[model samples]
Target: MGFFNMLLSLAAKGAVILFFLLLLAFLGYCLYIKRIHMKYDHIPGPPRHSFFLGHSPTFLQVMKEGKIIHDKFREWSEEYGPVYRTNVLHFVFICVTCPEATKEILMSPKYPKDKFLYKRLFNLFGQRFLGNGLVTAVDHDLWYKQRRIMDPAFSSLYLRGLMGTFNERAEKLMNKLSDIADSGTEAKMLHLVNCVTLDVIAKIAFGVDLDLLTNKSPFPEAIETCLKGMVFYIRDTLFEFNPKNRPFINEVKEACRLLRTTGARWIQDRKTAMQNGEDVPKDILTQIIKAASKEENMSKEDDEFMLDNFVTFFIAGQETTANQLGFCIMELARHPEILEKAKKEVDDVIGMKQEITYDDLGQLIYLSQVLKEVLRIYPTAPGTSRDVVEDMVIDGIHVPGGCTAFFSSYVTGRMEKFFKDPLTFDPERFHPDAPKPYYCYFPFALGPRSCLGQNFAQMEAKVVMAKLIQRFDFTLLPGETFEVLDTGTLRPKSGVLCSVRHRKYSK
Candidate 1:
């Protein structure tokens, strides 16, 4: 009886201690929020979050079940205000949602790019070849120089020339889809996109032909493995204390090593083909070689960096485009009216033509708007970040140096003040007279550091959408809601399944 009484006493003490700790944590959070609010009390945001977790766990839970974080963020904004702070794993994330604040901070040189997560990829992995490529590197003169080196390849004339590549591959994609459509088979929709995007980038970036539509080879699988490779590092963020994480870091290194070896081989073969009087293709590799020859310092670095560029572009380029295209399709499939409107626009412009030429695409204003609208709804990336080099003030809020600044086109695109009927899929919102979405709806980002492949990605989407719509009218099957999966970019967590019927043009 005495021992039992002792045990009960211990349990009661443990419970009381836990309750006290919880109370103290709550008090700390209230104090922190109160302090932040007192100074910037006029600012806006959600209610006070947990001491360390902030609203991340709640938002992450919603996203895990296929809901968008933007919806919750906007709700908080309406209640709290546009500019507010939320903590994540002990880090307070200050969000600038007001359009004017977004412009002031993102465009300001004082607010710099943060290397928190992205740097681990390059500094830790085999990305040493980037030698200051746009995505991973800092915004410096050298970054600009390297960016300029690759710009001409994406220029109007160059992109127009690349249309032939897009056509051949897109037809292959249509034929593959038709086979599945005829047989009533539905594989992961994302898989088909990955294949086409790989084929597209292989041709455009490396000047190689990978008939991914037909090729069931391991090489493409290996290439895709390299692209899906980031999942391990991301997983590390969740289970940081796990000792197994080291193996993952090593695994990435080994993967990069293998990718680098294959890339070097491809480059050698391409160079040899060009040297032996063999007719070489006009593609991204050739463009890079030409640029390197003209530039003063692009070639002075270690050959591994150059070859790393090959692997980086080949893998990263394909994945980024694939993610964007997948999200676009997801949005279109969710909103059939928007899809039909786009189809109608395409039909009116090209008139049921089987082939979509560069010139034919030029007249697709509404089609272009549909693509833009999809991008706005689901940006290819969640947001871009910058580390403040010096103290900066956005709307009177002092952002101290060394603090990270994240500019979310994802969040900005959905802001109520920036977009009317923000959730609606109205492509007309992109028309000239429609309120301009300069800083508001930037999916490809803006300013000097914008996506170099914007034109290429647009052309790819336009061509693919036109061909698919011209051949097939798409509708969401029985029961499927368009949900955003915010991973590398906003993609459909579950593959978007649709019932596609051949276009008969009723009108």
Candidate 2:
């Protein structure tokens, strides 16, 4: 009895000691985070919401409200000047909207991606999500190598070949919309657009056809869930500990597993075909595998990293373009005069044409301007962050090394200093005679790390829009809220609810 009591006493004492030690370590961590914030004291920004919580709550609120983060950013920039600071917990992010600073930061390879932010993307919920993919690769050398290998897949020749896939998938969507148009049923343009883009990427990139339009595929829903999961994992501090979030976290993990499994199956099939000495389709996966072989010091984990890119390109190639198309339709439905001009341009250029060729896309000039204008107002992936490796002066503000600098295409695109009547959706702003918005207008981003698929996305968008305009007249459904939802990537909150009908042609 005596010995048992003594053992219990010792265990109780150990627990107390360990708890106090943990308390001290947390205090130390808080102090270290505080010192980092002190370095940016010279910079102007909104006052932190709390000494302990910082600006994280405000950020969460903005996200939950379904308004674009850039809206709040614009307000802050007007009050705090072009360059300002914001904090989430211990990390301080300085947002620079000055055109010169934007150019210098984006154009230079010296400023690599912010390691802290990109690293989060590397592992979501302790699973490797975007591991060293071109978008998330922090090491500049590795990124350059990866970029070089993937360049051919996105080259002009390759993209021109993809025009057929784009048009074919787009035709499938128009057929689906035609059914809805005939029935006078409301369609969520974003959902259908997402289906078409997903099908296009699957067929073109992987040589696999996902008939998402015919059958309701779970892939789109899984990707959407994963995107929402990213926001939850990134923001919610007690994500793992909270029982309420466990189901959601599990769903995200399963989604990741599903994607990786699909990628593995696709990869294995390609390898089998190659080993059998049989003819195999030349696709993005084939190109990626070949690229990996050519890379010096290629590790056995090369295939795993390729899966990283599979998920990256799959999500990247589809979501942003779909969201952009949805927003373009919404804006067109709201503005009838602008819609008629675009419709007329499409009719004059395309006129019920069966194939939208590369030359035909070029001739749809007004439609091109309209697409550019849509991105100007609503860039899907709004901003990019860079790590300041060296001390630099940005717009007369001396920012220290180890600080994160953020540049928002959305915020910059909407600024009065960059665009006249910034809130207005004027396609005329992109007229050939009009001066370009310079550094302010980057829908696909700028510099060496700029979206390699910019031309590809633009082509895809033009084809989809041309067809939609050629076939149907769309009207926004009543009680639909036209707002942007940022679940990692910006998309329409209501999924762009609209009713479509076949256009009435004069005899």
TM-score each candidate.
0.80, 0.95
Relative to the true structure, candidate 2 reaches a TM of 0.95
In every candidate, how many clashes are there?
9, 0
* Candidate 2 lDDT by residue in tens digits, 335-391: 999999998898888887778998898898899899999999899988888988888
Q: Which residues of candidate 1, in runs, are more than 4 Å off? A: 1-80, 86-93, 108-111, 123-131, 217-241, 244-255, 275-277, 297-302, 505-507
Q: Which ten residues in a row have the lowest lDDT in candidate 1?
A: 231-240
What are the root-mean-square deviations of the candidates from the true structure over C-alphas?
Answer: 8.0, 1.8
Off by over 4 Å in 2: 1-20
Q: lDDT of each prediction vs. the true structure? A: 0.68, 0.86
Report the C-alpha lDDT of model 1 over 1-507, residue by residue, as the tens digit: 999999999999999999999999988977775564454334345655454455656665664665666666666666656656654553445665666766766666555556665565563344342334567656566456666767777789888888788888888988888887787766455678788988888877787777877777455555544444453343234533567665655654566666677778888887788778788778887776667667765454534455756766766666666776666776777777887887778878878666788888888988888878777777766677666566566666665554455567777677667787778878888885787776776776666666778788888888887888788756655666666665545666666776655667666
